[model samples]
Target: MNLRQFEVFHAIMRTGTVTGAARLLNVTQPSVSTVLKHLEAQLRFRLFNRIGGRLQPTPEAQALLPDIDAVFSRLAAVQRLTQDLAGGRLGTLSVAAAFPIANGYMARAVASFLTGRPGMRMALQSLTTPQVVDRVASREVELGVVHEPVGSTEVDTELLLRSALAAVLPATHPLARLERIPLAALEDHPVITYLPQNLFRFHVDKALAEAGISPRIVAQVTVSLTGIMLARHGAGIALVEPLMLRSLDFPGLVARPLDPPVAFETVLIRPRGTPDSTVLARFVAHLRDVLRAEGLLPEGH
Candidate 1:
């Protein structure tokens, strides 16, 4: 029998009479009787018996009651789950981000997001710019944060923040005396920064090439935080975006805006045509607020 027939059968079994089943289902008694007759005809057996004007379930109807109850139980669970998702009360959000954002602002933003979201879960992974793009485009991660100007056009991208590179140096370094360090000044000292494969490294290379200057290369690191740490130990000067500074707590390190600023953009990405979940959308909103307050996100956001 169909779902409606099963529903009518279940109601009749529960109340044990056509009049009571009609009342429970908010239908006329004659309508309930007609539906029950059709249901028994489809089943090719008698499901109920009318004796002394009282309806009694047959052995077969009693045997089928458990399965019908299970169906209703599962349906009720789906309804509850749907309500939770629509109300933003429960869901898991998976996000992939470049190292700087994952360690810095996103870490704090996630802590703040979990304050009252007891049933919500969040997974944050640190990856390179290209890896972030790949994960988002492949639908492996619902959201991505990375350095802007992503190479691929398969994902939807939005500028999340705009900030210039910062010059990180040892507290005792000579450039620490300058409010803004010029790129040419770095020529005198070894530079510890990202490896060439990184997207941001391309910009650093272009800027140096345009100036017709070659800075001493001390170390090639994977992320800005690593470069900053090395600079704190007097390895060399480190040039990094400002967001990277938020994750560091080196008391012996100093930061200055690069002169003739080398600006950069942070982008938010998602797989093309993938709809945003309520939980994901809420967390993204929270992230933007935190970045804006930290002065990472641009104004008029």
Candidate 2:
């Protein structure tokens, strides 16, 4: 029988009366009777019989009930899944972010957002700004978070926050005693920072150049996490983005503001000409809330 007829049969089996089936299906009693008649015509078997002025299941109907129930069960599951997907409660979220955020704040955001979402799947990637731009431009990922200024015009960008790089040093170090450390004060100290070619490193370099101070560079690393870890190991002072410091507790390390903050913009880069995603927006909200709570992102600005 067709789905409509099957639905009527299933409803009657559930309610045990044609009038009750019509009420359950939100249709008229005549329509429900008509569908059951057609279903019986196609099957060439009576699904119900009149007994004591009420409808009772036939022997054949008793055997068919199990299979029909199973089919309707599957249909209900399918409908539920479609509703969940349309409501943004179930789906795969493919996302990418720059190093510090990917390895740091993004984890907390994803974890908090995914709480109790059993049907949701996540794919998180960590890459440089150039790599993030590539994935966004190719639509390989739904969202990419990066620190500006990225030069790519292929993706639409929105600012997440304005933050800066800071100096992290051993707690016992002399620099840690100061509330803010000046770049020129590093003339004699060993400094660990990003590689010379990195975008964030450019800002630090410019600040140093404008101040005409060339600190002793003992180590050059890729991500801010690396610089923080190196400093934790007595590797002089680390100049790195301090966003992750909120989540990372290095007992031996302490972070201090730079004399002149090396500022940067955290941004969301997404595929151009695409529809907006509720999941992506919710994830971003979780990310910003985490950052704001940690003081990585200032409130209201």
Candidate 3:
């Protein structure tokens, strides 16, 4: 029998009356009766018996109830899953981000995004900018967040924000008393910063060159997080991006803007032709809200 006929027969067996079946199926009683008749004709067996103005399930109906119940149970589950998917409440997301972004703002964004999404499982990986770009290009991750420019033509990039580099120093350090640290002031003091090969270092070097002093480089770190940590523990002063520093709580450290602010672009990258899903769209909106609250986005954004 077709699905409609099976549905009507199952509903009649469930409530044991055509009137109840019609109400359950949102159909007229006559339509329900007609479907049951058609189903019986197809099956070559009566599914119900009329007794004293009431309907009773036939022996054949009693035997088929278990299978019909299972079918409807599965259909009910499918509907619930469909609703959850449409609502952006169910899915798996894979994301890769640069070390600083992961340790700072993206961490906060994920916590907020997953607040009520019990069905959305996610993976957040920390990688360098090149690694982040590679992951997105190869489709190993759905999205990548990094503070450096990505030259890959395999992905689409969107600049999220431009953030300034600041000097982080131990609270007890001499530079800590200054509201803004000039690059020249750091010339004689030991500094912990990006490796010369890194893209972020390019901006810092150019800014320092304009100040006409070479930084006294003691240690070079790949991630801003490492430099910040080092500076917190009486290490050399750190010149690094401040995006991740917004949420930091290093009791012994304070971050001061450079006299000439050095800025870098933070971008979100995705595979070129990737189609958007409801869950991904929801997460992007949630992420922007987090950035706005972090003061990383325009107030009206």
Instruction: Tell me the whole-model lDDT of each prediction, alpha carbons only.
Output: 0.84, 0.86, 0.85
- Lowest lDDT sum, 10 consecutive residues, model 3, at 241-250
RMSD of each predicted structure: 5.3, 3.2, 2.6
lDDT of 1 by residue, 87-176 (tens): 767888889888888988888988888887788888999998899999999999999998877878789988787778788887687889
Candidate 3's C-alpha runs over 4 A off are 111-118, 173-179, 182-188, 212-215
Number of clashes in every candidate structure?
Answer: 0, 0, 0
Model 1 misplacement above 4 A:
1-84
- Which one is best on TM-score? 3
Rank by lDDT, highest first. 2, 3, 1
Candidate 2 stretches greater than 4 Å from native: 37-46, 87-89, 182-190, 210-218, 276-282, 298-301
TM-scores for every candidate against the unseen true structure: 0.71, 0.82, 0.87
lDDT over C-alpha atoms for residue 144 of model 1: 96
Q: What lDDT does candidate 2 reach at residue 52?
A: 72
